[model samples]
Target: MIRKTMTVLALAASLGAAVGFGALPAFAQTAKATVDAGKAAGTVGEQADGFLAVVSGGDAAQRAAVVEINTGRAAVYKDTAAKTGVTAEAAGQATAKQLYARLAPGQYWKPLDGGWAKK
Candidate 1:
């Protein structure tokens, strides 16, 4: 079961990296600048579940941007999950791995079972 799940996750991650995260929805694109700025400023980070998170000291605008981005991501993850036969959570985690690989230096990320860490 574990092996099968891992295999599915690997396939899902590949698909997400190749297409899912690479192509943001129109709504997400609109908020991308805000999230990118927040990330550069150390106020926002990508979480292990394929969503943006406010690490610290985020204002209302940044919070709103996070919500917008996450909502878009949830939609994408759900679609990907349906196509890939995995749970939406699993699809998000797969995408998260791809996102983590693309993180820049000085950025923060939180693992599924750990506190935030800088890369």
Candidate 2:
């Protein structure tokens, strides 16, 4: 169990670095502002699957932003999984750890086995 935890942590670190360095696609970057706004408004949140979710019934714009951002994240996770010899789902879950750590106070987020909660 410890070994597995360590491995996941390492992968999270690597994925975080890639994301922090602006590795997301241009479409994701373009939608980031809207996503941020949604988060602040409690309409959007990060999921344990390394993608954004609409916590509330968000407007069309917010939902669109989430879709755009998630699409980019899916591509990044797939690429990282290939490079690191892990499954894409594993890569995404690892990245989700890093993402959860960065959540600001009052932002909503959901765990894999639970409902949404405020950070």
Judged by TM-score, which candidate is best? 2
Off by over 4 Å in 1: 1-27
The residue-by-residue lDDT of candidate 1 on 31-58, one tens digit each, is 7778889999999999999888999999
Please give, for residues 57-117, the per-residue lDDT of candidate 2 as tens digits.
Answer: 8999889988887877788788877776777888888899889899899999899999999
Q: Candidate 2: minimum summed lDDT over ten consecutive residues — where?
A: 17-26
**lDDT for residue 50 in candidate 2, whole number 0-100:** 88
Candidate that would win on lDDT? 2
Give all candidates' CA lDDT scores: 0.80, 0.82
**What CA root-mean-square deviation does each model show from the true structure?**
2.7, 2.5
Output candidate 1 Cα RMSD: 2.7
**TM-score for each model:** 0.81, 0.83
